[model samples]
Target chain A: MSQIDEQLRTELQRQGVWVTSMQDLYNWGRKNSIWPLQFGLACCAIEMIATAASRYDIARFGGEVFRPSPRQADLMIVAGTVTKKMAPQIVRLFNQMADPKYVIAMGACAISGGPFKQGYNVLKGIDRYIPVDVYIPGCPPRPEALLHAFMELQRKIDEQKLTGADKAEFLKPDQPSEFPVPRFGRHDLEPRANPNVFQPPVLER
Target chain B: MSATIETLEAMERPPVSMASRLQGELLEVSMGPQHPSTHGVFRMNVALEGEIVRKLKPVFGYLHRNHEKIGENTSYLGSMPYTDRLDYFCSMTNNWAYALSVEKLAGIEVPERAEYLRVILAELTRLQNHASLLGFLLSDMGAWGTPLMYAFREREKILDLFESLAGSRMMCDYMRFGGCRVDPSDEWLAQAKQIAERFPKFLDEFEDLILGNEIVIGRTQNVGKLSAELAVNAGITGPMLRACGVNYDIRKVDGYGFYPRFKFRIPLGEHGDTYDRLMMRALEMRESVQILKQAFAQVQPGPVMNPKAKIRAFRPPVGEAYGHIEAPKGELGFYLISDGSPNPYRYRVRPPSFINLTILEDMCLGHTVADVMVILGSVDIVMGEVDR
Candidate 1:
């Protein structure tokens, strides 16, 4: 897509690294088996559970196994408000996991602290301590939104061809930050002009 | 008198031994605070003499976050989503209880259509929860994911219906105090109607798969048996009470919402054991399906939300009330104190999981460790509700 990206790809290929054109492979793998650690703190955790149940069916995307130990997990889907008291435990969990870990800030509270940002006990943003791959922006995102975030994460992972080195990029302290809050609804705090529904108008055939 | 009492004590202590003095050689072991099947982060210090439990003392507060304190700070509207966090399994029931309480305090009237919609959603929520919970119980029994997958398939349909109406599937936050936040379009209603029609077939399929299985029956029946008197004393309601042969469904006795309008039989089981609990839930799901059918037929197209109620920065008058719903687990009640402000003065959740847990030791005293999990599973304690 870009000249530098092409050059990088060719350079990597020249170095005897196998280049697979199936760009969605990473996404496919991530999508099928999202082994989440069973770590929940507050209200948002219920939403996380709801996501796992019959209706949202997180199992469809292959994240059904809610492992208790941090070592057995692939994605750390942080589901509730992270308090200062619990910060070290979270850091420890993050540290314990094997390489190629992805963190999904599952609710508004986790993403820039949501409504609890003003509170003294709440952490400002989880990114302050650990790097976040995706931010699901909602007071508490529904299971569907979480599934969407997972799909999006898969796409990003596949497109980048994120191997060990790309994972290392995130490990560096001075690396550029890319915590874009995934947009699912209107950005405006106020209700939009089309209050009847949130869909763009369908044009006539 | 003191000398006589000492003489009597000396007369009674003829065959004393160190082993008998040490609590009949009962083995004391802690089962939880980390065990998988206690539901939440709950610890039970159990003293057992072989397979029979001598005593059990429950240890809680590990998952406590002072939910009431947080509710005091959140506004009436803000607390709606917070309610969804409780009983994370059946969020609709949680939302309804909160809305009902606030509405009662504010004296806001919900429209008939809205009431019908609420009933339909609540019943659907009940059906989905029971199905998923049964699967969870089976998993606890070592059946693993087969049943859970089946339950999830049906649950997906219900959630899709919720998604079509509300923007979110699980934490719907769809029900407001006066009425619903959004109306179901014709398409959504049709989907619900379809689900209602086909649900029985799915249940039939489920029955074929697991209900009649000899293994399930042997594992569940006559295990963790509780008498009707004990169940009532424990304040258990819904399917648990029904399992104990009490016909007291809150929907029947304390008629609220559109439950009064619907005609359905409350199913009761003879034994209040794990098997009966499962059977009661299964039957309750059938009843919910019927209620859905009736609700769908009677539902009239109109405004879902009450047009007259001004909900902007919702503020309720100063009052206190307890609102309870016959949730899938049991009676989920919300106790709210509003001091003429947007936010509640004090809010407490009568969490069914926490309340039903009062009799865990009673249920597990004579049962094996494996049966303890099965019984806990039948109680259907969601950690969110238990912890909150």
Candidate 2:
């Protein structure tokens, strides 16, 4: 609608030529249309739902489409307490997500296991297994806090370069795209590639 | 525990090849730890014969963060926030339950004003919780977020009040051992009184929207009936028990706090079906409004906390105490063992959600798989409490 845009379009149409960086277009598309998995783990999940509700609608940021299936989603908002029982499933869900996916560690629990950090069952943070794009801090962050994390994630996404190993990580066909899903065994088994964790018997039999 | 259709097929192929009798066998399905309908991180291993459920096994601990273990290791005051996460929707009642246990352990008496404040907040919590339940129950039945949004609208007002009072909406660790953390200013009281007065109009609107729906009635009525005797045997308490026509309410039985001073009725249901469970909550919200009105009016000038109550390094006598209260869900109790130390020797929470869910398989015995959600929703198990 602007004068320069009309001229550029006409000129580009006439010449059948356009100029733009690959990374800019890719990041622009990814940043604006993040689809969060329709997943919630604990107390912070309530706030996450509140954000999805009418008051602080995440749709404004194009993050409201909560895909029940992880395969369809691009963002995983690790919303609440990740216990040992849930850690494997969380890893599986993350691995099932398609290439070019992002994860936002949403609260104190997902960031550092929160007040439950002292507990035996809690994982210290989710990033020990999966890469995190953003970390929002609060016992359970407010809806606004989550929105700020969204901004932070968007900013991080915008900073990528279409060169170097990072570029190959996103663009290459042969690059690895999955992590070994943790499994239940004698003690909980970590994903094969990740270091094994020691289970401390915190309570007496 | 959700497996994609692809994964489900992959799962079925191996088992189906081994068994030739498909006509007489039950299909096993795992629903949730990450479902939209389990309320929170809860999973049910359901075996189905056609549409009817043959067996139900709820596999929990997915949300277990060891609340009691951490509480036992921390200072008395440090555990308040952890309690909020257990039954996250009913944080006020959770706070009061733990505070009551500590108060009992220390033999510390709460002031009149604080008792009145606790009653107000607890009742408000009940109103919001039941409202939320109704919203979610209807959603589980396949109506859209219209009812839930309206419920959230009412709940958001209460959350705003909580935010003003305790600095956080959902996790309000507002209650202390002998009293509340902050006394209500006159302005706060006036606003709360206004909300309490206006809440009935919202309830009337909610009742109008939900009570007459044919879909709700047909789906819920006589769907998941639990007999009174069986429910009692299962140790099922709270609204689930009341729905079976049991007259037991901890407020009336134990007479904790100033419950006896306040005049209110316990809403009981005739049949222990999902419909009755739903009605019990709506009816109880009316009763909560009654208590709130009385509590707000009767609150007088007094110290919020007893003068002798200390904040830190609180040492109780070497003994144990079990303090129970009629939380919105059911009988919420805290069992604490003190060794005359700053930290409790042992801390155990008698979570109502966890106990109420004990009857899930019993209730789901003959019902269709669809009704399982209704029964579980009716039970209202927050996994934070269940797994903790």
Winning candidate number (DockQ): 2
lDDT of 2 by residue, B1-388 (tens): 2323343343445445413444446688899987878998899887678899866777878988888888988899999888888889999999999999999999999998999999999999999999988988888888867788888888888998999999998999999999999877888988999998999999999889887889999999998899999888877888889999999999999888899998999889999999999999999999999999998889997899888999878888999999999888888999999999999999999988888887787789789998999888888878888888
What CAPRI class is candidate 1? Answer: incorrect
The CA lDDT of each predicted structure is: 0.75, 0.85
Query: How close is every model to the real structure, measured as TM-score?
Result: 0.76, 0.90
Going through the candidates in order, the fraction of native interface contacts each one reproduces equals 0.15, 0.77
DockQ of 1: 0.13
| CAPRI accuracy category, model 2 | medium
lDDT score for candidate 2 against the true structure? 0.85
Candidate that scores best on TM-score: 2
